[model samples]
Target chain A: GAGVSQSPSNKVTEKGKDVELRCDPISGHTALYWYRQRLGQGLEFLIYFQGNSAPDKSGLPSDRFSAERTGESVSTLTIQRTQQEDSAVYLCASSLTGAAANNQPQHFGDGTRLSIL
Target chain B: LAKTTQPISMDSYEGQEVNITCSHNNIATNDYITWYQQFPSQGPRFIIQGYKTKVTNEVASLFIPADRKSSTLSLPRVSLSDTAVYYCLVGVGLNDYKLSFGAGTTVTVRA
Candidate 1:
């Protein structure tokens, strides 16, 4: 795709249910990132992936949240036993390079709005 | 990661030059200042970035002092369409560092 894309623009699931959000980064982009934005709040970093190397999972809020990326393309963010506090917009972004470089601008996706009932 | 502080909101009229400033008291030496604009229900878009002094692009201008403790994003002749949330980020130039977006400065451009 020409830009980063996310699936299921909106999802509403009951509390305690599991959910999965997907992201398709721009072709050739080696770095991918995930973030969460609560209502009327700034974006919160979740995780990052640089190619096939070990991902930076330091930002995941808890053990219930996990993510995976295949090669350098599609990625999925999975939340087990979702809680109401987990409701937010899940945003995905991709950059041409990894964290070492300072000039690559990250292209973002529209994000998936997740609602926990 | 360096933390940034910016205004929560600002009001402006059309054709006015809006300048939003961000303060990063503990900014790192290698960190660069970048600004992004995000509209309602949409993802943020990169506007401008700078290391030191001043840098201007087609969208906006980034002004950083020699101390690099703070930076400002200047939007010239802002239109109604420019109304959005502007975030000031400090990081090592777009790698995978955790981007801590403080409550962005919401600029409301009225006609």
Candidate 2:
């Protein structure tokens, strides 16, 4: 892809239902990140992936929030049994390399706006 | 992560130089100051970054003082299109660490 891409720009699901958000990062990008932004709030870190390395899942809000990345390409953020509080804009970003590279900026996607009814 | 503080909003006339400052009182030695601009319903776009002193790019300039306690994002001669929310972030690393976005300063460039 030309840049980080996310699917289903908007999603609305009832409470207790499940939702999946997808991200397609730029080619050759080794670092992928997921963030959540609630209404009128700052962006909250969710997870990060670098190549085949173990992902950092420390930011996932709860057990219901989980994410997976295949190699260094596409990533999926799955929210099980969604709650009203889970509604937010899920953003995905990718960088050329890891933290050691100072110039690599994290390019972001338009994001998926999830609404949990 | 170093916590950052910035203004919530600002208003400017077109063709004005707008400077938005962000304070990071506890910035670490290894942290870098980065700025991002976000439009409505869109993701943030990187503007410029700096480790110390001043760094300039085509879009903006980042001025970090010697103490690194605070930094300012200078948008030169901003136009109506430059009206957006600007974020100041301090990150420990380029990749792994989370870049926290505080209540960004919304710059409304009036025509």
Docking class of 2: medium
Return the TM-score for each candidate structure.
0.89, 0.90
> Alpha-carbon error at B76 in model 2, in Å?
1.3
lDDT of 2 at A37: 88
Q: Give candidate 1 misplaced runs (Cα > 4 Å).
A: B93-96
Q: Write the per-residue lDDT of candidate 2 for residues A1-117, one digit (tens) a residue.
A: 497899889999999999999999989999888999888888899988888564578899899988888867999999999999998899998888876776577889999999988
Candidate 2, position B11, lDDT: 99
Tens-place lDDT per residue, model 1, A1-117, is 487899989999999999999999999989889999999877798999999554688889999999999977999999999999999999998889888887677778989999999
**RMSD in order of candidates:** 2.2, 2.1
Clashing pairs in 2: A99-B95
Q: Report the C-alpha lDDT of model 1 over B6-100, residue by residue, as the tens digit.
A: 99999999999999999999987778778888988888887887889999999999999899999999999999999999998887464436676
lDDT of each candidate versus the true structure: 0.88, 0.87
Which prediction has the highest lDDT against the true structure?
Answer: 1
